[model samples]
Target: MVAGTSTALGWLLVLLFSAVAWYLSGQRRAGNKRGKLPPGPTPLPLVGNLFHLDPREMHRSLEKLSKTYGPVYTIHLGSLPCVVLCGYQAVKEALVDQGDDFSDRGAFPVFYRFTQGNGIAFSNGEKWKVLRRFALHTLKNFGMGRSSLEPRIQEEAQCLAQEFQGKKGVPFNPIDLVCRAVSNVICVLVFGKRYDYEDADFLLLLDHFNENFRIMSSRWGELYNIFPRLMDFVPGPHHRIFHNFEKLRQFITEHVRRHQKHLDRNNPQDYIDHFLLRMEQEKQDPQSYFHMDTLVMSTHNLFFGGTETTSTTLRYGFLILMKYPEVAARVQQEIDRVVGPGRPPCLADRKAMPYTDAVVYEIQRFISILPMGLPRAVIRDTPFRGFLLPKGTNVIPLLSSVLSDPTRFKDPASFNPANFLDKEDAFQGNDAFVPFAPGKRICLGASLARMEIFLFLTTILQQFTLQPLVPPAEIDLTPLCTGLGNVPRPYEFRVLPR
Candidate 1:
């Protein structure tokens, strides 16, 4: 009874504290409203638009708000007023046409707490630019987005297929297998080596990443991002996010230390070696972003970016293929016709296999991973669509809306490869297809992801036939969760050798 009373008192104190903080934040917000903001629904005191948003389907909820309040409008997410851009036209105008104006990384509390405004993903201003440029330059030198990396991906794809072959067409979850395979591709580039599939430590780290992604996509994570201050006092799975981040950080730090011991200033092997060299060169400059913390955060950003979305897309794509067997049959036919069974699928053959190419594009479009495309902040107070967006205003370019715009797609609800195919059955592209987003802040690993997805999916299909446990018509394509990324529903499937 005494413990219960203490807990009640604690809760009361927290509520009172939160109310005061909200009031102060609102007062600061009023002073910061530099110009006439876009029109939207009025928010209530303290809660803001929490009641209006369904945390589970945040992107969809925001998209629905567009119907009532035009394409571009403002919505309050717990004291923070965020400008949401819905559909292709609005998103394109802001992210593409007015790219510089909306180029800054927005405030994302879930990531901000861990990153602390350090990494390539969360950092803003000069730090973001320098780190991004250096990472891109180093990646290019190491063959990112180039044909030179194809062999590495192909080798990993074969290992993945061999692992599936060991399954003997039996029911087994391919989550770890696919994740290991995908992560290893980036692993080779970032760490300069890949761990054995049976390595317990590696598997545990992968599990942490998987679990973190799942939790961050859950409603708990959404709540954390919205009311970070209040949620810090609460307890839930969301706490695991920081725990996993620490584990990931420890792993990266160990790798960085190991690389430091074997430092090669002239003969750089991978990303870490290159970064270490840069750190040495810039050690004299006090303001250099090339430091230990940034290195770890940047590595984490690249490693996570390279691993999660591509693997999830492949997993979801496999489910879609099983759900629609005819699509699988047609892809395999194209594979056999173009590449033959002599070798694995390469980037070159993508042009010849238009159907397969279209399928890959359609899969990315259908899944719409990273639906909200990591929020953006306006760099300065700027005129936008007759409204003035103040400096540091948060904006959400709803990539989900762009991918599913009715004007851009014939039937946005259904998954169809024809969305990327022309009347002549040739591979085509759409302006609305901003899966990696548009403009300067696009995902750094976009090209690597494209190559990985194409190679991994085609290689798997060439080697085995995907068999679902349930009827094709009954296979569900809905995501298990919708935050962070569109997490595919987990299932076990059999893979038969072709």
Candidate 2:
């Protein structure tokens, strides 16, 4: 009896010790996790603030969170430590002062799968460097700022004018028309020509592109990026997005192949021709990143970036004009004074139309297409505001804060062009108007985007005055979606002939 009791006691002690050890180990792990991270909202185990987040209005949610946690706050989305930077001062410090250390774009699995780490938008390191340099050089050569591209833009603008004329003062959805005009600009640059609006292939491509953009900003996109391994098993929008990406890839590849077949060494026409000729020149150099995959992805990036941003801005511009008719009238008046009906408005006319210029600036500031300004990663250990940000830390600069900061713009929430103009009614540029972003990773298409916005706005305003189709009480300019970009709710408007 004594021996049996002793043995039982020994076994109980061993089990007790094992339990204690396991408990201590878990405590140590929790402590380590806390130490590694900056102070943030307490999260549940495993999920880590996933349920607390609303992926659609993430910017608004983060803004509220910033108010509680101060300008710089950290949050965990699953295992990812997302550091949100609010206000202009914090954003400028990280993005501009420490550009090199913060230049790396955080690679999400879904984006990686889509882009395959090939394009300038998503790719990092030496590959991005080479492609970006080449893109800027090539774009400049193809008349990005020069007058050579003006005729092409004017051609597209004329088509737009014709479409508006066909509407004949009736209500119409300008989304498709605007998209076609913007897409043609990219098409001319990439494929060297424009497509007819009724062309079957062109329509299909546009639909596919639009669908892809929508899906990318949906809830499924957030889930797929957060838990890619698990989401891969599900059948839904994620699956469709993947299929669309593949289709786009194939389409771009075929175009690249055709360009290769018709390559001219001396006389290159369009982006593909230029790329193909360059590829041959760099064939002997093993370090050359110029190849079929990169070329296709770059072309795809240009198409996606060029079309979506410009079109969305124009869409918002019309919506804003409808919301504020007096503002629209002023813009039309400016257009009439600066650009007569017989002559098309040139870029030089922007200087003369101060109110028109201020309105465009206000639209960019108010809409803020890319609110988050793309996700950037710290390439090296850096100090931001006396805090140590380790290498690979995800830094998201909230550009909306800068544009909408009351300190910077009086009555930031309202759409007032006076925010950009002086008492003399002259155009006054502000350093805080950073819609296209700034520094090393600033938008490659800044000049092109500016030109497009100015030209498109002046052209449309010169021809028609946009007004709401519904009652003033029914019109809502509140954003309906936030993903790859912030898009306004769908609304109809009549374009009355000026």
Candidate 3:
């Protein structure tokens, strides 16, 4: 009996050693396959390249890595392999030529928790297609690109002017004013009305959304993506972020219910009304994706996308104008020559005021708010630039690299409007200038955003000359805190009346 027991123990030991050998052999084979990928910094086990990433200065860090690893490189964030496309050529190749293969957005854990694969931005497959199509159609019906919406934007712009006038030329942060104006534009489109700057509900919603944006771009947020199960148990900023998201969801849900009660099938006025009509139209279809949940999420996306992005861009526009007084003067001169103070500038005037138009384009290029344009996934095994991108691989298109490509722009680092102005003195559009991203998933609000930037900047420049309170050197152009967008540090300037 003792001899038999010893033999059995010996057999168990042999089996355990064989299993260990097989696992190590599999890891070695995976390592060999990874070796053929585009070059990048060597990663440590488990953590991969997590220690190398700095949440605050991620853009700068990525830019430096691009210098060493060529324009296309791969890095592992924990077990997930992320392929970074840098420079204009690399980004254009992945985002434009092969757009269909690379258009699927990678589902981040935190975003997935909030969005639940319902909204346009974070969704994929048939749901994303349906939501995106419905959103575009609904926005068009609500006068997005038509003349009907021009008056609404003008009204918001005028209200913004009045708010700034109330400042009495004192040095004050203009961020709030810009935020209110931009948010109201979406409010008019989504809810068919505008809110006063002091409205309690509006202010609360803004605070909640802003907090959510800030937290999503923080270190804690990154950690959550790495270790979701562990992070969920710990009380920290991620928990606060989830709380803010819940507040926003509740706010949107209330608005959606109100819209449903008052929706007019015959006269669908705003996005909510139009969506309600569509929901009824498709209610009988079992495969239909249009419903109250999606409507609420879509409205949430429109408000979040339309408000934060445009406002941040305009805020930076003013900061740039203040820093470069000469540029501001030239833009005002162009506006005066083409669009006098007697008339409010329209999108049509963009063609006439070439210099002013160039300045606006340059601001979008320089700011590059969405540095790492939303991550995309490979839906199927695909070949991207001679590299075998397996299905489910996450790809990141680096917008900062494209915006600041020295080969494309004359002086990419500096705020130079001449980059967009040709010898003929016309606003020259460059193929490399891709602020709204590219191809299929480009910003849905691109047309509206362009109009707002031109009209608002021209109107303000026509009325007042933006000047720094102190010397230009005193102005801080460095980004404040990296959020869902790049935000300028809070500063005050004197808006000298023209």
Candidate 4:
């Protein structure tokens, strides 16, 4: 109780001091305009441009800002100057061509508070290098991009198909269904096992994940990132983000503890087991990055990232399919020809099914999940697009700019698979199709995610004809909310067995 009270007092002080800082910050923004930085709107004191940005849709706000200020511009988040990199040129120059210098994860208050730089997604410098390298090596050994792990995905795909089939042409929301399938895949990799779909405990855990995504993408999450100390003093659903993560952390810690009791160094069954083995090996090194906190956080990272993204992607993809029945028909036709009822779809089938592959790419492109993309910080004082970005400045690689760039994608505003196809109708890919931002900080599980999305999508589409309860014309494609992520509004659809 004392600790809670003390924590509350600390936040109150932070809020009070921050209010003064916010006021002074507004005065500083006018000076920033002439400071030789990229041109942007003059921010108000203390609040900076906080009120200028729409909390419900930051990507849209950032995208709109880019229109006036040019691709490379700066916006102040509170007193901090965040450089916004819009369009393909700005994003690529920073994230890809200048990858290493811009590789460090920019500090977002919510993730910083949650991760504390302990895991792959939010860590930086040598710590990020070590965790990322080890994770890649371990993932490779576990058959991330290789053919060896295809069967595991195929198995889950089959399970998902069965679950959908069991719904018996009745209307149901696919969010929870796909979340379970996706999260359980990470469970297999992290815990060395899968959860029973009907297990009461597993269902409860999934509820937490479902809520976390909703809250994290909601306005509450955005406000937390902007005014953390202030929000820390107050109470709202933003607090639920931490509560949910705590539950997830507790769950991960319990698994880690359980694994510690009977871990086999010689026969590492999963990511945790492998990490445990690595920790033991690095025990003698004082600067070792492999430790229990890293394990717990990284484990949580995989489970959190591994689930929400791909699951939400698939969920949104299906929603799109339901919206465009003709597109769905074309994909089904391609899938039926390449992968018949006799066999399930595999990664290899991706090559054989051009139309279906295009649909998958288009889904990712249209939705543009992580619309603003993950934030990156300048590693050092750097020259970029004719401007000097000082070290430690937070950067926004506006992926929405790339994915929806009118110059790159012919019909950027529309959902058309041909954007990823050609006149010859072969499966094609575009550099602008960077749903996973490129560079040193590119998604660690990109391959795994790709495999799951393709396999799960094909598996389900192959078996069932997804139809919205309402006519496709009536379906709304606009996201319900979009701050850090684009969350599709809830809708109902039915699965008719093919």
Candidate 5:
């Protein structure tokens, strides 16, 4: 009896130690271990704080979490550890000051499985350097940030205005019209020509892109990214994204075949022409990242970025104007005062039109599109402000936190253009206004997007005074959804000629 009792006590001690060790392992993953990393809400084993995350309003949820854990904190998605940087200071410190350390794109199962880390958006290190540099150079050469591209944007603005004019003051959903016009700009650059808005194939392609955006922004996408192995076999909308991506890939592949047939080495017409020329030039160089898959993926990246973000901003901008017609009136007044009523508004007019510029900035800030931003990864172990983020850990520079930092903005929650304006009514810019984000991974088309937004918004307001179907007070400015993209609620407005 004595021997048995002693053996039982020994086993009890061993079991107790094992349980304590297991608890410590979980704490380490949660960042709850003091001195190991920043503090955060404790995470459970395997799932790793999955229950704590709000799927739809992740940015808001994360913001709330920041309140509890402070600006820099860690949260686990499944087994993966992500260090989230909240507010302007934290994001600026990591992205701008320590750019090289946090330069790699974070791994997402969906993106990894689909893109295989091949494109500009997700590619890292040397591949990213080569592709991004070449893309910027080619885009600049083709008048992306130059005045040469102004005519193309002007043409599209005119076309878009014409489409709105056709509505004849009737309440209509302008999503398709805005999407087509904005997409054509990228189409012209990448494909060397723009298809008619009425074209079946063009609309079909847009639908595919739209569907992909919606799915990627849904909870299904988040779930797939977190628990990809299990989500793969699980029947749901998550699988549809793979289908959409494949279709897009097929379209790009088909385009590549046509581009090869009409290859022009001496004088390149567009992005496709430039890429093909580069591929040929580097055919003998085995070290070259220039290849067919890279071209296709890079082209897709340009298409995805160029279309979704800009077009959605326009879509959301119109919603904001309808929600606040007085703001729209002021913008129109500025456009008339600066550019006059006849000529199309140009990028040159942006400097002179302070009120209109403020409205544009305010719209972007209030919307805070892509709130969490495309996830970034630490290249190595990073000793952040009081936190030591491990190597290869996923980093989320909470862009919305910067855009709506209460310390910076007078009214962070409400839609107030004055947040971007001074007492003298001058367009006073805020360092926290990071719509295209900051750092080395800043949107490649920042200049282009800025020019597009300014020109498009001013031009539209120049020709039409937006009138909401219902009272402006009734229209909601809150985003329709908030997963991957902070999209505006679908609302219709009639365009009245100014």
Candidate 6:
């Protein structure tokens, strides 16, 4: 019986080796068919270059690899080979110069599993184009970036400030407050109304969103993206991501259903109303992208996109201000001079408040949120820098490298507003300051996000000064984790009346 068991184990070992050999030979043949590609560390049979990467610090790991392989190189995530574009020039050349060719969304299994190629973010081709255009139009119609939306944001900011005042100078983590305030802005557009800050259901939904964003930015999420099929059978926090998504999905679907019942094609109230109208218009068209599934996914895209990054930025920005009191003071001085606490900061005040504008821009650059940016893919076979990328090859544009490139910024390591200030102390924009990324597929809510960040942050400062629990020098700006997002370390602070 022992001899038989040994014989069976020997046969299993032989099969494993045979599979590896077959995969390698197949890779060789494919390499011959595809033209020259950038060289990088050799990958193993099935795992590819997974070992070479530090899953926790994906952006830094990719940057380190760029040191040896130059700006553009190829690294495999499992069997999938993604071309990495590091530094500003390479990234700009590919994402900007050859925008159309590399305009497609790459395979992001984690999000795709939930979205199923239905939303604007994960979907590709004409479906993406249609949904994106429709969503943008709907958001604009609902006053997304225009002056009309200012009242909604200003009202929300005032609510946020009053909420802080209610804290009575007690120390507290501002995550939920900031998230709710930021989310309410999108809530107005998507759901047609905002929620009370203490609303249990709304708070629960925010909790799930926060948890999902944290987990999706964890090592488990990175591993899932690389080896999704394998990670499915394995257990970890990554599973929570999908579970949280289902909760959000159910919430959005219920809202969608409510809108469907009160559908008025003439007077569409919000995003859901607009989408239901579109679905009715396209009901007869079999090829139409408008459907119940797409509406839910698209609404999820706008709601999630609107909330997460902007709130995270505010949370991180507040921490930075606490760390550098002098910078915060300077911003407050600018605010006092311009807005003078008479009203909330407006977009029109931006040009006059150069220092505050510089500070805001600097904060975005310093954190480098979405460090690796979203993955991209080539729509068709394209040649980049004498190397041909196949029709569907995945691409990673390292935005962190661009933001922190020595060639681009004088001192990329430190957090200095001077990086964005010119000789005359005027606000200067940099080509590399693309926190929203640049291309046809740039974030749909980029303009609105800019407005919210500026208004909400300035409003908070206008009402109170952020007092850190620890000394300014002792405050650490290091992120808690870095994956899809650079999550700032958690801390509690008191807001003294300004």
- Local accuracy by lDDT, each model: 0.90, 0.79, 0.80, 0.85, 0.85, 0.89
lDDT of 5 by residue, 16-93 (tens): 443454454443233323335667888766666766887778888899999999999988876677888999999999
lDDT of 3 by residue, 346-410 (tens): 87787788888899999999988888777888677778776778776777788888999999999
Candidate 1, residue 179: the lDDT equals 93
lDDT of 3 at 76: 71
Between 3 and 4, whose TM-score is larger?
A: 4
Instruction: Tell me which residue pairs clash in candidate 2.
Output: none
* Candidate 4 residue lDDT tens string, 339-405: 8889999888888888899999999999998898888987887788788777777888889889999
Per-model TM against the reference: 0.95, 0.90, 0.90, 0.93, 0.92, 0.94
Residue ranges of candidate 2 with Cα displaced over 4 Å? 1-37
Give the winner by TM-score.
1
Name model 3 segments beyond 4 Å from true.
Answer: 1-36
Poorly placed runs, candidate 6 (over 4 Å):
1-32
In candidate 6, how many Å is residue 148 off?
A: 1.2
Q: What is every candidate's alpha-carbon RMSD to the true fold?
A: 3.6, 9.3, 9.0, 5.5, 7.9, 5.1
TM-score winner between 1 and 3, please give it.
1
Among the numbered candidates, top lDDT falls to 1
Please write out the lDDT profile of model 1 over residues 1-498, one tens digit for every residue.
Answer: 999999679646645655876765553244164677888889866657876888899999999999999999988887788899999999999999999999999878899998999979889999999999999999988899999999999999999999999998789999999999999988988999998899998998899889988988888888788778777867788999999999999999999999999987789999999999999999999999999999999999999999988888999999999998999999999999998899889999999999999999999999999888899998999799999998988899999999999999879889899998999999999999889999989999999999999999999999899999999988889889988788999998999999
Positional deviation of residue 155's Cα in model 6 after best superposition, in angstroms? 0.6
**TM-score, structure 4 vs. true:** 0.93
Span of 10 residues, lowest total lDDT, candidate 3 = 26-35
**Which portions of model 1 miss their true places by more than 4 Å?**
1-31
